[model samples]
Target chain A: MDKLRQHIEDITALSDEEYAYIKTFFTAKKVRKGQYLLSEGDDARYEYLVLSGIYKVFYIDEQGREFILQFAKENWWMSDYEAFFREKKATVFIECIDAGEVLVNTLQTREKLATEFHKMEHFYRAKLTNGYIALQQRIKLLLSSTPQERYETFSKMYPDLGQRLPKKIIAEYLGVSRETLSRLYSR
Target chain B: MDKLRQHIEDITALSDEEYAYIKTFFTAKKVRKGQYLLSEGDDARYEYLVLSGIYKVFYIDEQGREFILQFAKENWWMSDYEAFFREKKATVFIECIDAGEVLVNTLQTREKLATEFHKMEHFYRAKLTNGYIALQQRIKLLLSSTPQERYETFSKMYPDLGQRLPKKIIAEYLGVSRETLSRLYSR
Candidate 1:
């Protein structure tokens, strides 16, 4: 797709012929809101690049408490990555928050493309670098920031998300109670 | 730099000449225990690949409480990654827990190597892939696991590290009080 082309080109340029060949590896899928892309114990066979909507990657604890790990938006990637990369059964769930299409690629394709195209390898490394930084930032936030500080950081970092997501989800992401989130909101 | 060669070879094969050229980009340094490899406000110019020794990458909160983000052992990588990649002032501290040697690498070197050698690109990508998976595991633990569960996971993941690290530091890493860690240790 043109979108997939644009996404890869944003990291490393590819010729029209190269793009055509590379694009063959990805398959498009339409997802409805509330549909599950991945569930615990399922084989995580593919990783997704969102074309249009929001999604959440989460895990459920023994007591059935759900904890959100991260959100995926348009142009973002999402998967139960541990399972996807290691070929292990999924320990997390990926659910569609808003209906949209995503382009899916399997591990075999990722390896084949990278092995064939040096530029593709470069593209993947670049993306991983950014993802690594983001996860580090999240760890720092989780380890130290106060609840109010977290709310402020979250709103600042994802202004659109803050406005669009339910406050309940926002509170869960921040590791705060609904009442605490309400107090912060009133301020 | 045989260690460096072996590290790369573990992910992808390289010719002798290629390995020689690639090794030039890395410089080895001997670190002393208690010395700080990186500190808040430093430029975070290099990422370190441990050859021998232990290191902690951490941050101090406004309340002056230290929070450990991660520990680096032999074959592990450590850096103020946000600052390393973004070229920003460091916001974290990297301190040596045991004196030993490490291979230090610059961003310029990493980018040059990856761009010049496709194998190098694949090598870096593979390493980042593992790093990303480990960070995801950390996030999952932080969000849901109980202290006892976290302790068990940590011990199982790093049996040697469990024996070597001070319980205080282990407690910090697990987000548990030292007393809680002591209780876990007793059991």
Candidate 2:
């Protein structure tokens, strides 16, 4: 709860009462390695804040190839955001790669927090602003960087993630082949 | 001014005074075809709401390949969003592909609006929410869809875009080779 309190403050300064209100929405869960956190076609009932552990968020392509979209570690949030926000079926799979703990909150609970607390909405807006900035930067990186450059940058950005996940998964995230990732690593 | 009023109403219900306050900040501009609305390293001063014409937001890759990140038409907004919000130098480029009309507002103006009018923050929050949802869907599409599927989906999403731009540019936007785009078009 202390960490979650700090996380809420990191977005926008929250009042004690407001923080207490938000606390009611989040429930802590311990997930084991190789456990599935979310699967395709299911309604995304909750979004999770990874308290500890490595989690991969990926989608299966038409040819049944898995494409890793993101990895969430401690302090990071993971969920099929599209499904979670849009009230749609999940389009991605989230699996725990390392045993982890997360604070989970559902859409209804999140909305209630926003409606009941102005500070909460401010926090969410600020978070969405930063998320948009990150997504904008990622789109630029995908457009501008070569696969090797992207791989190098990814390794630098998520130092722990590179070591925790398989090269094949990183390759998919960087839009490259495993052989290409090997060559890049060798270089 | 009438169009601006209509646009605001389309997004959210605003009071007459609030609408007037917003209108005061925006200045309409006509952008000629082939003009660069924004350039790399420039101060991204304004966010433009497109009233007409096509604009491609893109960046040049290491190998000097141009990759299109987004194409904006009527009613869509374009800016080097990172720079506009952070008051930093722009990394992305926004160019007019046709003679364009837009209503432009600067960060300073937006800040004033947010500070003076609480409703403006709510309106901006709503805009950011839609943008967030769209971006999440785009990432999902990028991860799950093939280039051909992307092209088809993009065409469906913006039916007018295919007729407005050259095939090669659209191919770049879809992250496919020109040859592959030609084959997809044939099919």
List candidate 2 stretches off by more than 4 Å. B115-118
What DockQ does candidate 1 score? Answer: 0.83
Worst 10 residues of 1 chain B by lDDT: B1-10
What does candidate 2's lDDT look like per residue over B1-187, in tens digits? 5877787677568888778768888999999999998998999998999999899998876677888878898888889888888889987899999897999999888867765655565567667878877776676676567787788788898788888789998987877889999998788
Candidate 1: tens digits of C-alpha lDDT, residues A80-131: 8889999999999999988899999999999999999999999989999999
User: Which residue pairs does candidate 2 place in steric collision?
Assistant: none
User: A1-187, model 2: which lDDT tens digit per residue?
Assistant: 6989998888678778867767888999999999999999999988999888888888887788887777888877778887897799998899998997999999898777765665666667777788788777776666567787788789898887888788888898877789988998777
Global CA lDDT of candidate 1, please?
0.90
lDDT of each: 0.90, 0.82
